[model samples]
Target chain A: MASALARTTYNVFFRRSSNYLVGIFAGAFAFEIAFDSAADRLWDMANKGRQWKDIRSKYIQAADSEPADDEE
Target chain B: MFTRAAYTTATRAAFRAPTFAQARNASTQAANGAFGADRKAAAAWFAKAAAGSAILGYGISNYVVTDDRLAPVTKAVAESMTALQKKAAEYGIEMPFTVAHAFSTADHGLHPPHYPWDHFKPWKTYDHASIRRGFQVYKEVCSACHSMEYIHYRNLVGVSHTESEAKELAAEYEYEDGPNDKGEMFMRPGKLTDPMPSPYPNEEAARAANGGAYPPDLSCIARARHGEEDYIFALLLGYCDPPAGVNVREGLHYNPYFPGGAIAMARAIYDEVVEYEDGTPNNASQLAKDVSTFLSWASYPEHDERKKMGLKTLAISAMLLGLSVWWKRFKWSYIKTRKIVYKPGKFDEV
Candidate 1:
């Protein structure tokens, strides 16, 4: 269903009367990627890597524990 | 009308007895044999029996262990629980469950209220004086039982203490050095590069010293524990006598802040516990607050750095978003605002 919709959207963009629609799609796609990365960077800057369970693993209790059965 | 009646009669005759209503029911029962009335009634009876057995099992267990008249154990437990509940009332709250209570009786992950911090924010930094005083509090009080394994002497160079001060602090402890030519290990004075050493040599020794409860390391514990710094501060000061009814174990102490309303750690601080060189008041609360801040820094030396970078990133992202919007409007306006008009018969000439 989604692929069919995308095909229709691409067809509309490449058509002569709505040719500028292609530029808009390309620009929107690029902007979305850039915006996502910038948001990720902001989160990283504020959170300081403390919100992860792995960070808790650095504590003494976690260090003293035995490895899980599946883990090497 | 005659044809309809004939059809009904024909349908009824194909099933059991030729009576209309009985035959209709018989036909339905034959059609839905697997899911018929008898089968449904049997399933209902089985479900009812299962529920009855579960209720009976719970009641029997409760009678045997809790309210059992076989021994006076039930009375003692109830009396103790009632006393604990009353003691909890002194704090204007009561614990809903006890340590002896089954896990199924209570929900997990009971968090204290999230008290906000004035300094520990994404846009703010630690109060440096608090951090410094907190370190002193640790050295004087909490350091007796707790260890900060993740903190190193060098980690305090810029955040809490100067390089010379940190070095002197490091020199106070002895760390084991590697085997020399004789292949035997020896003790050496601690260096700035070394991590803070554990108080007891091993886990078993630490547990033995503290009645089978090893004191947890304080390193990064401000970040590690839920409720964060505020919870720690409250816990340090929340210790009190166990009112009338609660029975604390021989070694345990009453601390409402602990999950079970009892903790192995006794109250470690009193009024004027540690004298501050900077002449800050040496009250119990002040020490607790300062020590909590210091532990925060130990757990998160990168806090200030992260806050600074966060502010810069927020400003840059705002500018980028604004520019992107402006550029988007600039590029799309021609197509968006353009007006094309046509008269009904005038287009042919054009």
Candidate 2:
């Protein structure tokens, strides 16, 4: 049953040489994007509050409020 | 039967004649021309298809299916993958995924907790205001014992101080200068060119003043230490009374963040130790943080510039990668799309 499914898959995607080449290129592109994003997400999670992205909003808010306080 | 034999001989003789050979060559040339035209047409079609597909893929991905729209789907996929890995690990299966531990818990002292430093991010610049305050903390507090030998007053200009401010700060100290007209060394007011003056003239003096424990230079303390800025910040506030059964040597302070848990330099920063010119909080932790930042800047003056270069490299590489991908597809299209037919019987007949 697995062999039959594998044969069908090969025929659908790999039988044509052009289809095989395109699949390889597209797969590589997708893998690079996926891996990079995954690793970045994991790093961001590990350093949860230590990254600039985590604190940028609060920093901007504080800066915004400071002028108001000075005016008061 | 005789006439048929004569006709066969004539036909065989015609096959070896120059005119017959010329006709064969003409037909072969015609066939080659047709094949060439077919290949040219195929190549044009392939080029068009490749360019159209690339444009369509880029357009669809950029406008129709944008990153923000796909973010949730990508996040869900990542979460599921992580969950699957965790489940596998629970069943004594080893997944080929590992993250380096950020905080180390060694046999010596506790690892410093990670703090969200603004400058730690690749694209983020140092909080110049904080750095300025940190310089104050270093000047008023740390410089009493530790010497920043590698740092010059001029180095502070444009980073934590203005040129005039740095010059004024430099002038506060006195430096030994060469003899002018006399063969003797004389003391001169400090200049921007002079390195930060040592508290003691030499290491021996430093050790003698601090009871035989030499104070390390503060110039590269951030890099020299195990935990970098985190360790420095923690060591400043990590001072506590010796635990039960632990005998700290006389004149040594106990800071858990330090290796061996016994530091020679006593707690330097305290609440309101040095008042910030910018009216920043004067708490112990704040002072520690500022000093750590200042020392970090001293150790790595080009931190911001390095990150900026990294951002530039990534941006340029991404564009080049897209161009290269398109070029590769275009170059490979002809070879990849071409079809080969097997005509074994025809070749055998020829």
Best candidate per TM-score, number?
A: 2
DockQ of candidate 1, scored on C-alphas against the true complex (2 decimals): 0.05
For candidate 1, give the lDDT of residue B268. Answer: 89
Predicted candidate 1 versus true structure: per-residue lDDT over B1-350, tens digit per residue: 45888877876655433334444444444433434356777688779989999999998778755544645876788889889888988888858774575552113323455556656555556776677778889988888889888788877765555555677889999898989899999999999899877778777888999999888899979888877887788888888887688788999988766777778888987879899977889889888888988888788777766775677667768988988865554544433434488767745655
Segments of candidate 1 deviating more than 4 angstroms: A1-72, B1-116, B344-350
Best by DockQ: 1
Tens-place lDDT per residue, model 2, B1-350, is 45888878987775443343444444444443443555677578779989999999999999999999999999998888789888998998877773445654423688899988877876566665667788888888888898989999878765665555677788988888988688899998899889988899999999999999999998888889888999888889989997887788998888778878888988888999988865778999898888888889888888866765576568659978988865554544444434588776745545
Candidate 1 to truth, TM:
0.56
* TM-score (0 to 1) for chain B of model 2: 0.69
Which whole-number lDDT from 0 to 100 does residue B286 have in model 2?
91
TM-score of each: 0.56, 0.59
Error of 2 at B188 (Å): 1.4
Model 1: lDDT of residue B63: 74
lDDT of each: 0.71, 0.75
Cα displacement (Å) at residue B259, model 1: 0.6
